[model samples]
Every structure is written in C-alpha cells, then in structure tokens.
Target: MDKYTGKRLDGRYEIHELIGSGGMALVYRAYDEIDDRTVAIKILKDEFLGNEEFIRRFKNESKAIAVLSHPNIVKVYDVSFGDRIQYIVEEYIDGITLKEYLDQQKEVKWKEAIHFTIQILRALQHAHEKGIVHRDIKPQNIMLLQDGTIKVTDFGIARFSRSETRTMTDKAIGSVHYIAPEQARGDLTDEKADIYSVGVMLYEMITGQLPFEADSAVSVAIMQLQADPKPPKEINPNIPDGLEEITLKAMQKNPVQRYQSAAEMLRDIEEFRRNPSIRFQYKYFIDEKPTKYIDAINTVKGTEQPVYNDNYEYEEEPVRNPKKKKKSTASLVITGIAAAFLIVAVGFGLAALLHSCSSGPQDVPLPNFVGHNYDDVKNNPAYKNFKFITETKNDSSQKAGTILGQNPKAGTVVKSNSDVTLTINAGGKMVTIPDLTNKTQDEAVSNLQQLNLTYDVLPVEDANVTKGYVQNTDPPAGTQVAEGSKVSVYVSTGSGGEKVAVPAIIDETLDAAKKDIAAAGLTVGKITTKDDTGKPKDTVIETTPLPGVQVAKGSSVSIVVSSGNKSEKSIDIFVHLPKNVTHDINLKAYLGNELQTEKTVNPSYNDVCQLTFTGTSGKKQLTIQLDGNKYQVYTLDFDAGTFKQDESYPYTENSSASESVSGPITPAD
Candidate 1:
C-alpha cells in the first residue's frame, strides 16, 4: 500500500490513492473533509523534496495555475509547504489527456481539431494577457473532457513575461517536436512561441503526423531549428487551404513572421472558422542582394594581354627620321580636329531625334474608372493609347466585372501608353447552406465554415432538440447565400420546463428523499453520509442547494445523509517522570497508535503529567510515552469513557510508579 493512501494531511484532506505521477510530483485522488468534495493533490515526490530546482518548479506550477482562471485552463485551489512535503490542491478533472485521445484516434477531423485548437488558444490568450507564458505547451499538457471541453494543464516551466532579463538554460526545455525554433535554439521566447506549438499540434491533428519527427529528441530539435515540413494539405487533402495557411504562418521560422500574440492567432482562427475557404494573402519578406561573377583569368598574372582595336591598324617601321616625326605630329593634330567635328555633328542629330520622340504626344490625364466596367474601359477609343492591367476579386458590394480601384488617382498626369492597374470585382461567390437542423453547434459551425459563411448563434430553450444542437437556421437550408454572409443559427438550450422549488428532505429516509426529489423534477447527484445527532441512520440531513431553492427542471441535487449520532468518549493518558531528569520533559499521547498531541513539563516541579483525549466511540489502544521511551499501554472503551490495563513498563531508574490513573484526568482548558 502507498504510505499516504490512508493518511490525512493537515487534519483535513484524506488521500485515497495515487492517480498520477510525474517527474517531480505525485498526484492523488483525495477528499477535502472540510469542503465535502473530491480534489486532486499534487505532492512533490519524496526524492525531490531536498532538490532546490525541483522544489522551485513544484511551487512555480502552483503559482502559475493559481493566477489563471479560465474555463479552458486547469484551476489551482490551494498550496501548502511543509517540512517533509509540499503539495498543491487543484480541481479534479475527470478526463484523459489530449495525448491519450490523439493516440487512440491518430487522425482527428479538421473541424474537431479546430474546436480543440480554439480552446487551447483561448487559454493561452488569457495566460499571455496576464503576463504569464506557458513555456511548455503540447497535447500532453491539455486535458479533454467527455463534453468536448478542453483544459490546459502543467505550467511547471511557465515564466513571467515582464521579466526581461530571464533566460532559459542552454539545453532545450520544451518537447522537441512541438517547440518553436527560438525555444529549441535557447533564445528569448514570448507569446509567439506558444503559437508555434499550437500550429504544430494542429498540423499533427489534421495530418496524423508531427511536422518534424526523428529517432531522437536531439535530432528532432535540430529539425525544428533548420528544417521545414510539408504543408498539412499535402498529407491531408481534406484540410482547408485557409487553415493550412494559418498553420504554416504560425509555424514561421522567424518569431516576428509568426503570430505576435495568441490573440492575433485567435483572430486568424476565428476568421477561418467563419470562412474556411477564405485565403489569406500572407507574405514573408526575404532579403536578397545582387551578385556579380568575375572571370578567373582577370586575376592571373601571365594571362594579362594588351588591348587591340581593329579600327586602327599599326605597321612596324624601322628607325623613323626626325623630319618624319614632325610631319606625323602635324598630321595627327589635323585628324583629331576632324574627328571632334564629326562627333559634335552626331550628338546634335541624336538630341534632335530624342526631342521629336518626347514631343510625339502630350501627357494624358488619368480618367476615373472606379464605377465603370473593365470591358468598357479596355475598349474605349479615347483611352486606347493606355495599357490596362486587370486583377479580379470577389466583392459583394460591387457588380461583376466592375472596376473597383485604379493605380493613380483621377486627374493625375501620366505618360501615354503607360501601364494602368485596375482592381475588378468578380461578384460574390454564392454558396448553398447545408442542412443544420438537429446537428450539434460544433457540427453546424463546421458546415457553415466549409462554405465560407459566418454565423450568429442564438441559444433558445428547446423541447424537441438536445441542448447545444442547432434547432434551425434563418434563410433555411438550400438557400444560396453569398460567401461571408451571416447566418443566424438557433441553438437548443434543452427542455424549457417550469422552475420548481426543492422540497425539504431533512430527517427523512434516504429512499423517501430520493423519491421526493425525483417527483420534484430533480435527480440525485452525489450522496454522502455524515454523523448527525438530529437525524437517524440512512436519513437525509440536507441538500446541496438547501430547501426552498429554485433549480432547473432536471438538474442534479446532491444530498447529505445521516450515519447516526457519533458516540463520544474520553481517555486519561498518564506519563511518569524520571527522578534523574532535571530539564523540561515532553509527554506524548497516542490514540490507535497515532500521535494526538504532546505536552512539555518541567520534571523537577512534577513527577507525573496527565493528558486527556476525546473522540468517536470505539475500542481503541492508548499509549503514553515519556522522553521517547515506551511507558504504558491500555485498552480504552471509548463508548463507556473507560479503560482497562493492556500492558505496563517500569521506569529505567528501577523506581516503582503508578501506570494507571484512578480517576478521570481533566483536560487543560
């Protein structure tokens, strides 16, 4: 048996059994005696009690969870630090980790993936806004309930975002496969790092595979640093293009290129949820520079050669005469003057040609084309000299083929035949609304998103349909609605029955109370029994919401039952002091061999110290000891508040002393 299975901590929480174990802690399913409810206690592992690093992480987890209170985030109820143990009490979640769910179903549907991702993002969004960053985020840290709710868990490594000088260890901290590049590289991390992990999880959910995986964690970390995975659509063609874009965009290698915050990523996700087919024109900038290639021959010493011109021919001549040199100089001067005149004449002719081309046509003013059709503008005789470039976009507010915008504003001067870019509206894409009646809210949402449409959900009390399912949608099924159009979806809020007051069931039999509760349109929830004086055994003592409280028609009502009045009894514990003792001595009392209390007394002033204990009636063993030595043992009948001698021991000094008290010992007030 586990040491703590039957133990009570701080005289309150009773540990039942170990439910989970991690690197630094052990989680137990415990009951809070004070609160009368089940809670999960995460106790630091015995081996880590003395380890400072583990202790810090254990406390960090408690502090991190304590500050966050979101529907999708696990909640911390209490924290305790003791000499031998440290533990945190958190809400007991009855569910499996998302990792287990993924393992059971390797490939999750895209719509289901989005549902989980949205909850995770919301949790992160809340944590980030509070200046906390969950340095570790993965499916293993997410809890999935049966009702399709998600609770993010495990913030052991979370850090405060405002701590500018904080830095992680050189070794990678988070799970290698889902870690961001900056995290893997041991660089400063922020909210964008969590976004990257979410993207990886989305990829795995839709593609049934991790973006980067290798045989070892180090190899995977390396892959995260330098490798790029194939787009999710390649593995799962059913994944929508826009979702793929969002996923890859979040996984960008550069932190700045990824979503700057969880809210930013959530916006993209919401946009995708509204219009799955809506494509995002996300552009990433890459710096590039021109390169010049030089010939290797230009660097070789012996390869250098003199330049030769075909236009001037040279002839070798034997020693030239002085007279001939003078004649040649005069001839060269005359040739240079004639060449300069020829060059001037050519320049003048070229300038005259350029002026004629520049004056061929006057600059034309750009005409307004925002409201005109592209075809009419393209074929207009007056604008025939201009070159038109067209781009099409879907716009519900404009007619098909209508020009929506132009490059230059109207009245601007532009050269004739210059390029003019026009943005033309291609008309809104019409999509048929799928039948949503009887479908769950999530399913209905997925259907609408697949058609690039938005939805406004209105929850109304419904008698026929189940809660959270779509009752009906406005505009009806089969209607051809334009993309991005809002569809009003009516969601069922369960049966709309009349509210009924809970009747008093105190002091009634358990069976009778259950029947009365059921007749009042309520169901019995958790039933607990406690000792009470006013009620008999098996009688209902009270209800969770109390009597006369209003509740929904079919809501569950928890009742406390009586286990009969407890029999009270008292015991006198006596301890004999040694004559040789001169300093203060301590006397300890035990009931059922468990320490109840201890008292310190000066042995010089008194020889005998007495203590009394009162508790539930039962046959119990009473043991009293002095200075860590066994003194006496007795069988106490707590029902009769009496006792009989079981065993006795003499003082070590060989002195005779009374081991049993003749009368009841009065407990100190």
Candidate 2:
C-alpha cells in the first residue's frame, strides 16, 4: 500500500498516506493530479483480489456510485486496477466516523440525533431515486463532517447488496448490530433492509446501546433475525415516545413492516419530533411460551397448590402423657386440654379460609411480553387464578402489557387462593370522520385527543377553518367516539402546495443552477458540453416549457447551457428552414453568443437573438448553415433585384442532400 502512496496512481492521482483499513481493502488519502483534489483510494487486500467474485462485486458497486453524484453520498472519484491492486477512488471527506462520534458522546442529544437522522434520510432518498439501496447502513459507515453535515459512505462496499453491477458473491454476514432481518435470513436485501439498519443506528444513538447484544456475533445476528429488543422507552424512558415509535417502525423485523423508503423515514422522524408521545411497538414474550405466564400467576393465585395442609397428617391425642398412664386422673385432664386445642385450631383455620375467598382472587403474576397489546394477550385461562380486577381500554398507542391490567398492579398482594380479573388497554380504535367545524384547525382535531376519538386535519379548498373554526368531520357533527369513531376535519390549508415552474437554467453555471433546481424539487440530469454559442459555454441558458408554468412535485426539467467553448474547426453548417418559401429575410445574426445572454436566453424580452450567418451571393451552393454541423442544403435560384433589399430568391428545390441525411435546408438570407 505504501509503494503506491506519494506517487501518481493510474498516472493521475498522487497517492498519500494510509487513511484507514476495512474488511476488504485499505484506503489511502490521495491527490488527483488531473482534477487537483484529494480523494480516498481504496485498494482491495492483495489476497482478495485473486477472488474473482469479490473483485466483480467490488467494481460493480463502486461504479454504481461513481455515477451517483449526490450531495449526501460520498462521490466515487475513479476506479482502476494495476499491479494486482484493484482500487477505487472516492471523495475524500474530512470528518469523524459516526461510530466514533457516538462513542465520544455516549448519548446523542435528541436534536442532534434527529439532525443526523435527517441527513441519512436525505442520502438514502437520493440513493433510492437512483434505484440504489445502501444495505449496510450503520454508524461506522457514516461520517459527520466538521461542519456537522452527515455523509453516508461505504454503501457501495457491502457484500450482500445484489445490485446489478455487483461483481462477487460471498457468504455475507453483516455486522450483527446493523444487519437487517431479511439479510440474516438470506433474503434479497433491498431498501427496506437499509431502513431497518438506520433505525437500529438511531436506537443506539439515543439509547447509547445496541438493541440486542449477545456473547457471540452469531447470537446477536440471530436475535436480530428473530427478536426485537426492549423498546427504546424501556432503555431510556426519557427518549420522546414519538422518536421511539419511529425507531421501532424502522427496525420492524419484517421487511413489509419496516419503512419502505428513506423519504418515509424522514417524514416519520419529523412527525415524531412534532409529537414524541406516539410510539410504535409490539410486545413479545420470553421464549414465546404460554406456560411462562401461567407459572408466574401461580405464585399470586395459589391455585396450583391442591391444598396447603395436604402434606400434614392429623394424629389426635398421643396416648396421654407418661404421668397419665400412671394416673387415670391425669389421662382425663390431658383429654380436656387436647379437645380445647383442637376446637380453637379448627375454628380459626376455617374462618381464615372463608375470609380469603370472600376478599376476591389473589393478585396474578405479570406476564412477560415486551410488545404485545392487551386484547392479544388477555383471556389465557391460566390467568383466572389470580385476584385482580381487569380493565381493558383503548391504548392502541401503547404496547399491550402481557397481563394487560394486572392486579397488585405490578407488585401487590392477592387475596390468597382467589380469582383475579385484568382489564387490558386495547390499542385505540381506527376511524375516519367528517370535518371539524367552528374550532381552530389545530383545535378541531379532537379525534386523537384520547376521548376515543382521533381526527386528522384534512386539506380542503376553503376559506373556513380559521385558527379556531372546525371545517368538517367525517361522521358529520355529534358522532360518538370511543367506539366506531373516526373523524377528518378540513382545515384552511391556506396557500400551500402551490406548484412552481422550473426556470431557465441553460446559461447559469452548474452550481448556481443546481441550487435553484433542487429548491424547486427538480433534478439535474445529463450534463455534457458543446462548443460555445459565443456565450459563457457550459452555462445554463434555457429550460423547457419556458418559465412560470405551474407543475407538480419532482418534475424533471432539462437545462440547455452554453459550453463556454468554441469548436476548433468550422464544419458543415446547415440552415433549417421551411421548404419552397421565399420572403424578405432580415436576418441579423450572432456567430458567438455570450454567457449573460445564454443564461437569460428566454428569461424575458430582448434575450433572444439569431446565430451568425451570411446572406452572400453564392450561386454555387446557395446554402445557409448554423452550428457548423446538423446542416440543411438547398438550391436557391436567386432572382432578387437588389442584393440587400430583395429577400426573395427564385429557389428551386434540389432533389435533396444525401438521402441518408434527414435535415432541413433553405435559402441563406
């Protein structure tokens, strides 16, 4: 690795020092002599280069990203092989590893975690747009730049990602803490897997602990494949409930259950930040056994025991005392005492047994379930032995406690040998309602306010629903809640979601135009260069559909910019014109265009101009051309009386240019 360091690599990049070492390769900080920038060079370990499969996968993913020039993703600079060194050059980012940052902080602040998560989402969203998925998303592969932006790296280096460009197939066992369930199960990993991994990372960030841990890597991996760790709230109850829900949703064990895309994750995080009380979680029991719960209840219910005194034997009157044997009077006295003792013992025992039963059942044991809901776990007849009142309410928002509502609550005494009933908290009922009326839009959403109602603010075209007025409800007004309830209120979504037309970007520099395009929800595509149109070539000049046209979200617009260059040779120029037309041609043309003109070519009035052309007396060809290529040919029988005043040329059509060529030609004016 050092041999290539400090020298030109691939005859262009000047190798520098060893930056880091990964499982498959060693990275070096290098300088691109041609591009004149620092880059991270990753060279496959010498031994692994021999493995053709690994070599293929390594090259394919790298190439996948080389074309992905996204703001949040590390840019792949170049890829090449020489001297048994298969190296990939990427954008050199100066920053700390997300893992290192997490380790140093030990616990990321909620705001910081959210901000970091947002960056990751943006990166993933960008990847998804390009049809790529970063399967191994983890803290180690993320870098927090000095300026605090997160750069998602190492995506193109995963072994399990089966991107079409992958070159190798290896037994892929990802890091235990970050591997998604599907990957563990040897299922095809996709965007969902990456979403799960990000969720795990966020969990670790806020809780300062991995969701699951075991003695061996394999064990941890297995747990991830099959189990969910205790909810984030359990680890750090201080974490906002909303954030926990987002985390759980992201880490859902089933791919179908997890977030489908990074954009969705971003939306959830934003929602959670807005309201942390809403968390998504499910309960699970230890070893998934029903008996574990029944046994727990035994201690409280005391029903499993057939009888407390069954093991004891009652032996009445042990043949008086030795003294009684000598004296018949002593025997009589011992009998009287024994009879009294028996009477007292029997009376107290019977009374106590009756009291215990009358006081209600004993408290039942707490069933061990981490993420289940009440209705789901309730009614296991095994719980009948405990003495506890059951209360089940709509708490769809909360993971149902295995013993939904336990008597003795968590730890209380049951009337020994009694029956207990538990009322569990059920997840809230689902509903769709009419609009909220008269109340402020914000205040109108009484649906989810815990009165067995949950209402969402619906967007409607209206002048109503001012801050306090209810627009409308699903079930009209006065609908009952807590049972079969759902309401939607149309709030005054005033002046929102208005579409904006993409502006002309042809002549503007790439950087300047990119910012505007992205802000408008438009993407830049196919950047190439052509010789100057006399404007600052390569600069944006014009875009499609003119400007100010209202369009929907994520519209694709093309920018025709100046190349800021001039063709070295004057090639065949063709004039594209209507055939068999002769008229006064006052063609004031421009051969070389300017950048300012191109940038605002169609910006407004006075920005349009013609290309350079000459209306000379050339009877030989009588042809006009533009751009020196893509030409049109015509035979003009110029019968104009005046050279300057006469625009009409007695142009007769030549059969045409080469039949193979399909282009327009006309008289040169």
Candidate 3:
C-alpha cells in the first residue's frame, strides 16, 4: 500500500523504489543484501500470483534465462517464490529499450539499421544454436546500450505467455506492428519465426515505417500472409542494397525459403557485409483483389431520395420589384441605432481581449539542456514541461547519451510554459573510410558485418589473398565510413583459378590458328610475322607463352610466324622479271633480317623454285627463277644461276606455307 523504497523483501533484497509496473509484475530497483549490489527485482502482479500455471512458467523462464550467459542476452540473477509471491531478480540495465529508441527515431539510417541487425543477428545466432528461439523478436524486447551494443531481453517469455495463468489474453500479447505471421496463427514456431520478427524490426528501423498494416489486428495478420512488403530501398532509397536483400530474405513467407540457420544467414550477410554490392534480387508481386468484398459492394441494393414535407419551410418569397423604392423612415432610424450599439459592444470586447493578451508570463531564458541525459529532464518538475527530443548516435566524440550539438542555442528567450524543442546528437557519428586491402574477402566481410558496413564484389587480380580473397575494397578502411554505407570489395577469384592450354601454332594457317587456340581453351591476342620467309603473312608461326605452356587469364600470346613474301617458299605463286634473266640478276633474301636456314618447296609446281643459302658476303639469300624469270628473292638474295623446274624446293620444316590463308581476313588489292 505504501511507496516501495528501501523496504526489505523476504530478508534478502531491500527494495529501494518501485521502478516500473506492467501487466504481470511490478519492477523495483533493489539492493540484494546477499550480494551487496543493486539489482532489478520484478514481483509478479497480484493477479498472476493466484494462478499456479503463471507462477510455474514464471519460475521456469526465470531459472532458464538466469542461467543464460550470452553477452547479447539479459542475465537473470535469481528466481524465488516467497511470502505467497513470485519474483525474479535480474541484472540492472542502464540504457533504454530498443522500443524507446525506435519511438524516438521515426527513421534510422542504413548504418544504424545494419548495426542493429547485426547485433540482433549475433544474439539470435547464439539463441538458435542453443535450441532456443526468441518467438517474439521485436524492437520492444531489444535494448540499446550506451556503448552502441545491443542486448535482447525476454528470451523465453512468449512460451510463458502461452500458459492460461497470463493476465492479458494471448490476443493482446505482442506489441502491435511487430508480431510475426505464424505467431498470430498459433502455428509451430522455430528460429525462422524469430528471423521474420527481426526482419520486421529492420524494416521499421530503416524506413521509420512498417511494410504491412490494417485497421484491425486480424487484418494486419492476414496481410502478412498474402502481401509482401516493399523492400527497404523502396521505403528509404538510402538503405544499402545488400542489407535490403538480407531483410527481405529473412522475412520470406516460406520457412524453408527463409534462412536455414541463423549462422548461415549471418554468414551470408556477413559475406555481403564484406561486399555490400552482392545484393539479393527481389521479385515482388501485387496483391490480388478479394472477390468477397467486391461482390458484396456490387450486389447491395440501391437507395432513393426522400421527398421533403410540404410544411417544412418550403415556400419561396415573392420577388420585389426594384422600382418600388424604400419608404419606411422609422425602420431606417432603428437600424442606425442598432448599428451604433453593435459598434460600441465590439469596441469594448476588443479592449478586454487586448487587456488580457498584454498580461502574460515574462520571456524567461531557456536553460542549457543540451548534453543533459533524458532521465534528468524527464524527472525534473520545473522542466517536466520541457519537451525532450532524444537522439542515439554512435559517436566517438561524445558519450552515448551526451549531446553533440543543439538547436535554438541554449539561453534563448522563450515563453515560460512553452515546450522548447531540443535537438540532441545521436552518438554513433561517422564519415568516409579507408582501403580494406590485404584481407580475405571473408575476413573483410566479417569485419564489415560487425561494423554494419555494406560493400560490392568486383573480381580483381592479385598475388595476395588468393582467389575469393579480397584484392582491395573501395571507401578505404578507417576513412570514417557512414553507417549502412556500401563498401565494394575486389575479390581475387585468382584469375578464375584454372588455366587453358596454349594451342599448337607452329604449322597452322592464320584461319586454323585461332580455331586451334580456341580448342585448347585459349584465345589469340596479336599475330606478328617475319617477312622474307616466303610464308603467308598473319599465319601463326609461333606463340608467346609458347604453345603447350600454361599461362594465366588475359595473358597476351603473340603469334610470330612468317610474312607473305615468297622466294624460299611459295605455292601457285608466279614471278615476273626482265626478259633475259641476264647473267646474274643478282638478289639477296632474308627473313626479318635473318637467313632462312631450313626451307622447303613442293616439286609439283615446276614453275616454282626455292633455296636456303648463304651469300658471298656471309649473308643468307634465297632466290628463285622460273621460265627465265626471276620468280622471287629475299634479303639474302641469290643469283638466278639456273632455271630449275623440279627438285622439291627449299622451305621451312612441317610448313603449312603451302596452305591458303582463310578466316575473317581483310583482303589486300
């Protein structure tokens, strides 16, 4: 009956004050005499104490979570039933619940959204691994610590709420706008259900809005079954693409389609966190109109207008002729008197109103409310009327609750009772970033996931961090990246990791050259040749990285072979010269400034002649004479000593020189 302050309960805890009261219990900030520390003690509400089922569930969950040792989960210290009452002692938290934070912020930035998501994910991951699913995962159950860390409370309370001993009906259990679809349907719940709730929280955090809504709770539940909400990007375009995909995937209707495991989803998002660009492509569908409502509205009977009663002032006045001017002098005199009285009455009323307006509270200077904690303002009697604009930021410049900057500058003049709006800084402040290089793509992603970062993946070549490892990342690390930023990672798929062989290019013609390369899983780059070889130009003579040698992707392989010049080798090639091949129409031939040592020719073409020789000056030459004509000559020119029809002329070994050129060639005139 009295205020709860410093009154010992059951000789173990001294209740300092009643901190809060809810539907099922009264919470007090108490000192545990045994431990000599401040602890939060929640005594079951009077209504619940009488129900055995409620007491049993309360005892079970209290013991269950009290033993839980997760960093993200709230820890219960003790659970006891004494003096015909059940109470649970828990570690006192100094920060506000996530619901309080979300209530303060209608819309959170992508960075904040991701940061919150990751924290929730970590907590969920732990719970899922432990075989405990937080059936009711919503903002109200999440808490935001001063250090920018998150804590999840009420891990197993939903199951407790299922018992008949609960005060409120299950119908009113979950906070509006956050209950998952299956929970509403009373279906079996698992980890996927918790994930769905988290997705809803994420959607709300980023957009300051909900994806689905309805006039009644039932309709909202039904909407969840059939309607897919728009992606966060549609709500707030600033939301990172990867984060949006992560959110949508978590909220998928089919449990199987949803995350298979909390860790798996976390890993994927973490992978995305490494390269935020690898986004999930969403396929959205419009809702089909319900036929039941449409049919009812269409089939409704029509109504007709009712007739007015004759006696209901329906008669119209007869029109007066304009020419019939006014004649009543006494009426005019009365009208003047009435008008004068009205003026006097209005003048006095105006004077009274002015007199009242001139006597209001003096303009008092506003106090310095910036940087002051919310509780300080919320508790003050004088400043109780002082409007509070609470903001949470992840800033290294100031403490979590400390204010960074304020509006209306402190000490400004204002009406004494008027509520002044204060603009406090959200602590998690940040900016651009630095390079994330020399890290594995997985490692980079894990960091980003923890940092609530988003990035894209671009395949890049690198000697470090092998394939699938990060080559480098854009927005460079430590560059003050804003929360929810897209950080792109160039992962080294290490040149796709496999090598295609270099095809045989020595004897192939230009056309066959490319085909062979293709067959070997390789492609041609640039083709070069040496003239004076008497072979077709553009023909693949030899390949760099050389044939049969393995090379990395995109490596250039130049095909160096022979030019079109003919002398030491030719096929169906004719030559013109002076009529009398007079004595030594002396000539010299060379292949790209080199003597052709091994050359060949076909004896079938008697008109053709070929030779591989060294000149008198120690220079190599190859010249041919056909029917008294100097067919051709190279830099290592040879004298037209004799005109020979046969003898299987000189040429290069295994030469495809006799082959004609083909394949997408640019013809020469």
| Highest TM-score model number | 1
Candidate 2's C-alpha runs over 4 A off are 82-84, 156-171, 275-669
Clashing pairs in 1: none
Candidate 2 lDDT by residue in tens digits, 145-211: 7557888887544433343432211123456579786565444567787888889988888888999
User: Would you list the C-alpha lDDT of every candidate in the order shown?
Assistant: 0.74, 0.57, 0.58
What tens digits encode model 1's per-residue C-alpha lDDT throughout 1-669?
346777999999999756666777878889999999899999997656765566777887887888899999988988999979899999988666788777765346787899999999999999998888897899999988756789999998887777544544334577878888777655677888999999999889989999997776656766787777898878986676788889999899889899998888889989767544456879987646332211110112245342211111111222322442222345877879976997688655754564464536669999998999776676454676677888877898776678999998788899887889999886689788899999988899998988878777666555668988888888899997667667878787665564555666766799999999998889999999876343578887656665655567788888888878775655565455677677765556677757776767677898767667787677787776554545667666665454555655654321222234322232235
Misplaced by over 4 Å in model 3 are 1-4, 160-173, 281-669
Model 3, 438-541: lDDT tens per residue? 67766777878777666665554444467666666666656765556567666775544455445556666878887777655566787776755434676655
Q: For candidate 3, what is the TM-score? A: 0.41
TM-score for model 2? 0.41
